[model samples]
Target: MSHPVDIHVGRKLKQARTLRRMSQTDVARHLKLSFQQIQKYEIGSNRIAASRLYDLSRILDVPTAYFFEGLGDAPEVGARDHGLDIVSAVASIKDEQVKSRIVTFIEDVSGRTVAKSA
Candidate 1:
């Protein structure tokens, strides 16, 4: 029935993956699943088990709690919001530092930094 928490987590997963500039195939390879499964997970069509989610957190270099942040007041999340491919936008950068700086610049420009939320 697509629980809201599951949807939120999936959206967060997609965001984190994009921030890391990973493809669905990349994450799927780590999780030992098909890329289609990654797509399902990202869209909340399937729930990620705790252990698998933990493994994904490790692979994605994010804390386990990260996927749960900003949940209570979060807006509706899914691929339907303009179907934007955020990963491709960041994937062109080969330099990690450059990518990090770009992400920071985006956060600053969007005024959605952690301090603003706080």
Candidate 2:
């Protein structure tokens, strides 16, 4: 059986990759591994070593801590929240206007104001 921690990490990995708009092949190429290996890692079928995780962090342009976010929470609960991934992806947008527009669109659709940071 796959460990809960491992499954959590895999989901985070996949989430980061998706937020970055990267294919499994793209991430695999950066790590010099096959796409199947990337799939395995994302499915929790294979455990990722520390070095590999570091590499993934760099490739995904996220801090190492990103993978561990919400780890203390129940996996099902954490998995249901895509807010972090959306926020991260939006924050990565270099164009301020585009980011602002996206935030506005989200607020319009959700009918809730997102507090802006100073």
Estimate every model's Cα lDDT from 0 to 1: 0.78, 0.81
Worst lDDT window (10 residues) for model 2? 75-84
Scored by lDDT, model 2 comes in at: 0.81
39-113 per-residue lDDT for model 2 (tens digits) = 989888888899999999998887898888988876564455667567667867889799889878988999976
Kindly list the per-residue Cα lDDT of model 1 for residues 19-100, writing each as its tens digit. Answer: 6667889889888899999998888989999999999989887899988887776456652433235555665778979977
- TM values, all candidates: 0.67, 0.67
Worst 10 residues of 1 by lDDT: 78-87
